[model samples]
Target chain A: MSTIANYGEVQRALQTDTEQILAQIPVSPVTLSMPMDGAGPRICASVKRDDTSRVPASVNVVLDGNPVEIVVEAVGDYQDFKAL
Target chain B: MMVNEGSEGRGGDAEHFSRLFEWLNTNADRLLDDPATNLVAVGIGKKSAGRIDDDSPFCITGFVEKKLSEKEIASRSMSLFADAAAAVSNVGQPKSLDFEIDVIETGSRFRARPGLQFPAAQRGLRGGAAPTLDLQKRFETIRKGIGITNPHRSYPASLSVGTLGFFVRDEGGTTFLVSNNHVIADENKARKGDSIVQPGTLDLTQSELNLMPTLAKLRAQLEIAKLSAFVDIHFHNPQAIPFNEVDCAAAEILSDKRDFSEIARIGLGGDLSGVATPFTIDPVTGEVTGLTRVYKAGRTTGWTEGEVTQLAVVTDVRYGAGLARFRNQLGIAASPDNTGPFSRAGDSGSAIVNARQELVGLLFAGSEMQTLANPIQPVLDALSGALGAKALTVI
Candidate 1:
């Protein structure tokens, strides 16, 4: 019985490892060739809601674990919160 | 209404006529309120030092209000004055009659009988004698400009009954009253010994003979009262720094008896009834989002409320430094009759409070319907450092 339980645990761990490998495969990774002095590579991410009519689109950047969100509106245009 | 005093002879007849004339003058406002009484005038009657006659009855030779048919008004007023004249004649020795009524030429076209001296005639009386309409329109304009969401009391500074003084404190514990440097320095030739009467008070209009006692009383009151330090900047160019903006200065108090915090609380108390709070634009969407509720309390307009229509707006406001770009400016577009979000001519330095009566902005300018205000935190910081006292915070 003890041997059967151990085998079950090993199978579960193997499945988790396989899922992790598949998750990374779908995303792309990039590296900066020449980084500017005070500026780091800028990475932008765009997000859209499933119901486009209900929620507006948004853009965000993650810098040093800090997430800055930008709101884009149809009327007034783009605005950065911190800058205002 | 006419009271007829029969023709008679008595002493002090001139004095009696003068009293009657004064009575008519004082009732001008009330008479004007009557729709039937189209034209009202202040008539001065003069008689050659000692002659008397029946033709000498008080005459209504001119018009004061418009809309009263000229012919009809003339006949009616003449009859009324004739009645008054008869009453006066009954009281005193009959005297030769000479009388002139003062009326605004624009509204009242009735000419002054020749050879009778009268004060300068008031203008804009004819088609312009729409005091009711004028008052209503002016009220509406102010209400729209301030974004009236709620009704409040407002009195013109030129016609107010009290004085409003601003005070500031410095780090050294020195308190000062912030006002136009001229207000204290007596620039524009305000004599040093001249009294500084509060705006809208009788003292402001008192003659020298009547002003002495009032001035003396005020002086004595200042002697015992907590006097705020006065600063005289002496900046007197009306064109350079308009009185509205240069109208700002601070008075320092020696004691910490009052501060911005106290003012905030007082404002909140005044706003016990909750009000709508307004919000600025969401920087991300450029969309106006947030609370749309806003309110303001000024010396002139006691307290008013309105809604915010735009946020983060960039505008060109002409201030002391000429036209400058105002970024992230919040615009409150109020509905008609709501006097909030903006200060009028006399409300130059009033602090703008939120629905919670929290200090949020300072009202400085506005149009007939839109008002512009500066956020409170920045003003508090700037003035706090300059005042040397702890900046009052909005709870």
Candidate 2:
């Protein structure tokens, strides 16, 4: 199992991976996905339905790492653990 | 929805018609939720002095498309604002709208005009009303500097910087250096309480941004309005939502004698002595019309003049890497001679004052033919509420 702990690894893959380079980096090998479930940012009642026509949008692309975005929350909080 | 407030009267002139403002703020969601509404703009202002019987009654004005007839427009508007105290619960309550709603129909679909407003030769300089501002005194009272972000050892100076628009105290007695988000916050690179410098990075060498003493701490714009009120930031453009009427930011000044009237217009004293309504609209027809004169004093342009062509305009402006849509902005252009402009590159945060010496708006962006400014009323309100200000005042 691999935990790509930080964005640096993803960035490194994009810059040096031969396969990614050949593919012209069209799709990110490691993409970030913001969960939209009840645990995520608020969504309207309509978002639950199969068709999400009514769900509000997310400027995640333009505002991916931008400062303008306030972090609403995280899906899970983690604590440092070590195997004894 | 015109916001070109023509004149400021004595005594009761500073009134903002707070009840109406708060009413609209609290319940605007109902109207915006319906796509069919297509409600373009809204504004508040008094008539020009002597232009009407009494400029005392601060008016509530709104703007929509002209396709709808006089009857249809009024009928729909009344429906939205109907039943004094029922549907829109806050309509008639105390501290709610005390004035009547006047809806106007715009001739053209509002599309933001954008470009850069670097100074230009005034095709010609004509004589007009003599300026009331004490040029030398105004310059002496305030600090003149650039808007830069985090300067460090390697980076030296932040890549972004621009003009220091104005300085004023919030209700909490906290003083701030006012300018655009791109200017003070470096297009999103800065955080609250970050250090800022004058003679901005554009004006200063990287070495200077590193050496210069910090003049102020950054203040979060506080414009992160309620999420649910807006449709979605997840869309093509975000300003289309509620509560984003301006693109202003502030830095808590270390300590300086700064006021909203840091710079004076060519024809006025350098003091925002009072606040006035943004513009006037016809009660029955909803056509916006009022005081057409306005001016600004900026870093690059110095003192320039122009006409308030349109008020309450909803348009998109490009900055840095993306486009941000701004609504309820004042549009100015060189009249008579099609090429006249009011500001330039280093002038993004200058105060937009009317001929009567009242603070009208905050100059920010521009294009070849148009200069854009966030109307003054909303700027003040955003600071007061979002920033937790008690009694914001422009000296």
**Candidate 1 versus the native: TM-score?**
0.34
- Residue B94 of model 1 has an lDDT of 18
* Predicted complex 2: DockQ: 0.02
Writing each residue's lDDT as its tens digit, candidate 2 over A3-84 gives 3112222222222232322232122111112221223221111112232332223211112332121121211211111000
Model 2 agreement with the true structure over B265-352: per-residue lDDT tens digits: 2223355556657565442233445456776766655567777764444344566545554545676765564234566666677777
lDDT of 1 by residue, B215-280 (tens): 454433221112222222223254542112122223333222223333212332253222224343
Residue B159 of candidate 1: its Cα lDDT? Answer: 23
Provide backbone clash counts, one per model: 48, 21
lDDT of each: 0.34, 0.47
Winner by TM-score = 2
